[model samples]
Target: MAGDRVRERRTVETMIGMYCRGNHGTSAGLCAECAELRDYAFSRIETCPRRDGRVRCTGCGVHCYNPVMRGRIIAVMRYSGPRMVLHPIMAARHFLP
Candidate 1:
């Protein structure tokens, strides 16, 4: 179970990172994507940090590139397996209009 949890965490971190990067387009490091999502998710909540090496978007409840928060976010998101597979659509629904 612990191994599965670790794997699940990695998977969620990757997926959240990808979503922030906007469907795997040509982007640089997670920082760029983190910045973009920070701007996008800020409206829903204040103080979305892109500089602290971690950014959490309350709108979608996904943590972007923040090692500290990644595991927790993944644990929650993992419950929604289909949603993880359909992350782009799901993220859009939550973070977008």
Candidate 2:
């Protein structure tokens, strides 16, 4: 479970990094907005009610994020999800059951 959370966090960070780099034109690290979103995502993961970290957020019954953040993350996911092929290992680990 703990390992799962770490991977989940890494996946989120990777997606956000890709989004920030491509959209925000950050060459090195996350931009401020993406950084805040990353932190919020990490906090949400740490405090997730499903401590085992078994379920994908999309499949979960809980909608933990507020509307604005939810929309932002949905955008990030949409953009990065297809491009995840650029990061094959993370994509495989993320999608593998």
Candidate 3:
């Protein structure tokens, strides 16, 4: 469970970081848009019912995120997914699964 939470955080950070870097040209952290999404994602992760040993969000098909936030996160993942190969460790830790 602890590891899953860590994995979830790493996944959100990596995706948000990548999205912000490409879309906002920032590398130090997320931009305003991505930051908001990141905060929402972190909150969801913290309260995730499946944290004990769970299916990944993308595959789980759970509607954990609200519609608007879900759309935002999907966009972030789309833009950042291809770029994940660059951050192999973080990608392997959570993003891949």
Candidate 4:
């Protein structure tokens, strides 16, 4: 369970980091908006009823996020997805962590 939480946290952190870097041109840390999203995501993950890291949010097909947050995360993923290739280690770590 602790391992799952770490994995979930790592994955969300990586995604948000990528999104913030790609969109805001900052490699330092998350912006205010992305930070909020990160916090929200972590809260959702920590309280997740499923508790299975193997089944990701998309694969689980569970609409856990609120409508607004869902849309925001989707947009972030869409914007940051293609750019993720450049960060191979981070991308791979997200899956392997």
Q: Candidate 1 at residue 34, lDDT?
A: 49
| Cα-based TM-score, every candidate | 0.30, 0.92, 0.85, 0.80
The segments of candidate 3 whose C-alpha lies over 4 angstroms from its true place after superposition are 95-97
Model 4 residue 78 CA deviation in Å: 1.9
Per-candidate local distance difference test: 0.43, 0.88, 0.80, 0.77
- lDDT over C-alpha atoms for residue 10 of model 4: 73
Which consecutive 10 residues in model 4 have the weakest lDDT in total?
A: 52-61
lDDT of 2 at 53: 66
Give the 10-residue window scoring lowest on summed lDDT in candidate 1: 50-59
Instruction: Candidate 4: give its CA RMSD in angstroms.
Output: 2.2
Task: Report model 2's TM-score to 2 decimal places.
Answer: 0.92
TM-score of 3: 0.85
lDDT tens per residue, model 1, 1-97: 3333333334444555655455455365556544454333333233334323233342334454366445534443444444555666545533442
Among these predictions, the greatest lDDT belongs to 2
Residue 12 in candidate 4, Cα distance off native in Å: 1.2
True-structure lDDT of candidate 2? 0.88
> How should the candidates be ordered by lDDT, best one leading?
2, 3, 4, 1
Per-candidate Cα RMSD to the true structure, in Å, reads 12.5, 1.2, 2.0, 2.2
Q: Give me the overall lDDT of model 1.
A: 0.43
Those runs of model 4 whose alpha carbons end farther than 4 Å from true positions after fitting are: 94-97
